[model samples]
Target: MTPIFRRLLLVVFACGLPLMAVRAADPAPPPPAFQEGKEYGKLTTPMPPMVAGKPEVIEFFSYNCPHCHDLEPTAQEWLKRKPNDVQFIRVPVSFNPSWEVTSRAYYVAESLGVLEKMHRPLFEAIHRDKRSLASEDEVAALFVENGVDEAAFRKAYKSFQTETQMRRANQLVQRYGVRGVPMLVVNGQYDVRSPRMFEVVDFLLAR
Candidate 1:
């Protein structure tokens, strides 16, 4: 071949090789693994919200539930990193008369502004320490140990506001048709199950 043609051919071959290599190196992004209905189910009748505008992420749990105790750490970690727009709410489930006391403890702690302090300890006291926090008095003692005054806890536990919150929580739980503890409800629409709990939540949020 002529010198000019040979040089042109070499330049074209060098340029073509890089283009081919780039095409081979890049791959398509993998699709999301979470699926609707399988990973999460929608609430048959969407429950009404306690607030407007901000999306709600509710954790329906009970102090007496062993499974809820097991999931506490994961839920806490997720709380630290959850999206700013999301409002994380904890609703204590009252499955029966016995669970009502534990439910009251949640609202009382929230009303007294001690939920952040008492939340984990309440779980630990019940599951880790094997304490029986079944009665109002027993739960108030745990609150006292957590820095809340016994008198204040007693007053807040039976306050009109605390009772209203407790009633609303129970109403929502029934509306959602939640059957178990540690269940996640995303934006009042999706019921997220564990193992892939946060993953499904992240997916629903993206939608």
Candidate 2:
């Protein structure tokens, strides 16, 4: 063979070796159960009061949760790919009294029909923008600046509806036995938490 042709074949084989190995290799097996605890379920299913027919992907997260903020895109992409098949729900938990601001802020965003608009920005307010979204006034200002009418936001922030939603959040947290933010409950039954969180979900979905 010509020198150039021989060199080209060598380069092609080198590039294809890894691809061939990958295709020939068996995938890694799932990890053994470890994070499984008292409330954890095996082959679990979501609870009722759930919207029927739609599979639910509930994210139990707080605005102050840096991990949740980081995973937002992956979670968002998951939702987008299955919009019609899955119902995505965000449950904000108060890791402390200080985190209560996050719960209020979430509903306030929902009320304004801006969860999509403010979700990441709210995360940024704490993680990136270095802003305090810890108060109704501050959050309201954010809404106003973002073109959500301040008066409307203020009214909703103080609204009984928002308060009711907050109470509901507490109840759901208790029901799911969720102790941390950014935990995902698939169909309200199986909770994905700690080390294997996303991995567990991938396993559950694969099944």
Candidate 3:
């Protein structure tokens, strides 16, 4: 080849070396840490999230369940760092009459706009303090102690709206196939069962 032609060839090869190095340096993405039918199970039919345009993370728990109580701290820690795009919800499961009472209490607090204030106390009452909140009188007393008016607490405790929410909670428990407490469902698609559940949740959210 002529000197000009050889110079042109050298220029093209020099330009191509950096491009080839970049291609070789690019790393492949790591495989997913969790797996289907192992750490988590996908719903046969995925349900749409209650809140539109945002991912939902639901915790199906019961005040009467010791395991649920044990998970409270970890759940709260995860909530503190949960994605801003996530809409978290807690559904109190009622598998028996006693559980139904606490479920009603949860909805009552929700209706009165005191759920955040009462959630931890209720859990502590049942699990830590060994207090029994199995009756309306007992639960109402606790509400009163928390600065809620006795009359208003009683009214909301037995209100139709609270009952409706309790029913909805039950429906969600059934729909999600939640057979146990301290269960986490991601965007109504996967039911997480691993100990590293929040990790699985982060994985699903990234997906």
**Best-fitting candidate, scored by lDDT:** 3
Per-model TM against the reference: 0.82, 0.74, 0.85
**Tens digit of per-residue lDDT, candidate 1, span 1-207:** 999988877887877764234445668789767776678887787766558878888999998999999888888788889889899888899998768998999888888887889888988998899998889889988988878999998898889998899889888887888798889998888898648688778888889
User: Residue 93 of model 2: what lDDT?
Assistant: 94
Worst 10 residues of 1 by lDDT: 17-26
**Per-prediction tally of clashes:** 0, 2, 0
Ranking by lDDT: 3, 1, 2
Cα distance off (Å), candidate 2, residue 54? 2.9
lDDT of 3 by residue, 28-146 (tens): 88867999989999998899999988999999999889988888888889999998889999999999998898999999888889989989889999988999999999889889889
The TM-score of predicted model 1 comes to: 0.82
Clashing pairs in 2: 46-187, 61-182
lDDT of candidates 1 onward, in order: 0.85, 0.76, 0.88
Cα RMSD of predicted structure 1: 5.2
